[model samples]
Target: MEPDIWGIVWLSLKVSAVAVGVCLPLAFALAWVLARGRFAGLVLLDAVVHLPLVLPPVVTGWLLLLAFGPQGPAGRWLEATLGVTFMFRWTGAALAAAVMALPLMVRAMRLSIEAVDLRLEAAAMTLGASRWRVFCTLTLPLALPGVVAGAVLGFARSLGEFGATITFVSNIPGETQTLPLAIYSALQVPGGEAVVTRLAVVSVLLSLAALVVSEVMARRMGRATHVL
Candidate 1:
């Protein structure tokens, strides 16, 4: 691969990893709430959480820009308070990717949490275990497979994020230029088909690898849960 392509690959990996890392705790919390909490406006909350999945990627990107751009309210506050800027930056790209990937992560985790036997949790609780302890010892262990799957899905989605990332951060090489952005850049040039093809292949391979690893880990987790 060309040095440019390598750089793009590295940036893509970095952004996706960071996005997933930032998203994991939030996603897990939301998934737990959606899975177990029975309350008013639950449906509304779920819809709001999944709005990104239904919205156009470009629209989501625009919303992010409006909310997190340098002059936007949150953006300005963050910049003034913490000297953090998201506009035209790699961090902005990661934020966009995380938003795009969030729904998948939440959905997977929700399903996994829902599938866990309530009896086990209840039993643990009845044995004087605190709610948090029961969750850590029973619920979370059983839901590990699903959590892993969700993370893998989120990571893969982040790797392929294009419209949102590009709209929010633009395609600046060696900065916010991720794999998908690099492919888009390659396509605009004369006789860049080879580059496009190479990047496309790399993208497909990376996605496939993530899926395969997710499956393997989920299966292993399932086996461990069964033994426990």
Candidate 2:
């Protein structure tokens, strides 16, 4: 691969990894709430959590820009208070990817949490375990497979994110130009088909690898849960 292609690959990996890292805890908490909570507006919260799945990627990107752009309310506040900015930066690209990937992560985790036997949690609670302790010792252990699956799904989604990323951060090479953006950029130039093809192959391979790892981890977790 060309040095440029390597840079794109590295950037894509770094961005996706960062996005998933940032999203996992939040996604897990949301999934737990959706799977177990019965508060009012639960349905509304679920819809909002999954809104990106139904909305156009570009639309989601536009919303993100409006909310996180340098001049936008949240963006302005962050910048003014902390001297942090995301506009047209690699961090912005990661944020966009995280938004695009969040629904998948939440869905996987919710399903997994829902599948956990409530009896086990109840039994642990009855044994004088605090809710947090029970969750750490019982619920979370049983949900590990699902969490892993969700992380893999989010990572794969982030790796392929294009419209949101480009709209949120633009295609600046060595900065925000991730794998998908690199491929898109390559396609615009004369005799760039080779570059596009190479990047496409890399993208496909990365996605496939993530899926495979997720499947294997899920299966292992399933087997372990059954044994427990």
Give the TM-score of each candidate.
Answer: 0.95, 0.94
Give the Å shift of residue 13 in candidate 1.
0.2
* Residue pairs in collision within model 2: none
Q: How far off is residue 68 in model 2, in Å?
A: 0.6
Q: Count the backbone clashes (under 3 Å) in each candidate.
A: 0, 0
- After superposition, the stretches of candidate 2 with alpha carbons farther than 4 Å from their true spots are 1-3, 222-228
lDDT by residue (tens digit), candidate 1, 117-208: 99888888889999989988888988888788889989999999999998899989999999988888888888889999999999999999
| Model 2 residue 207 CA deviation in Å | 1.0
**Backbone clash tally (model 2):** 0
Query: Candidate 1 regions off by >4 Å?
Result: 1-3, 223-228
For each candidate, the alpha-carbon lDDT, in order, equals: 0.90, 0.89
**Model 2, span 23-43: residue lDDT tens:** 999999999999999999999
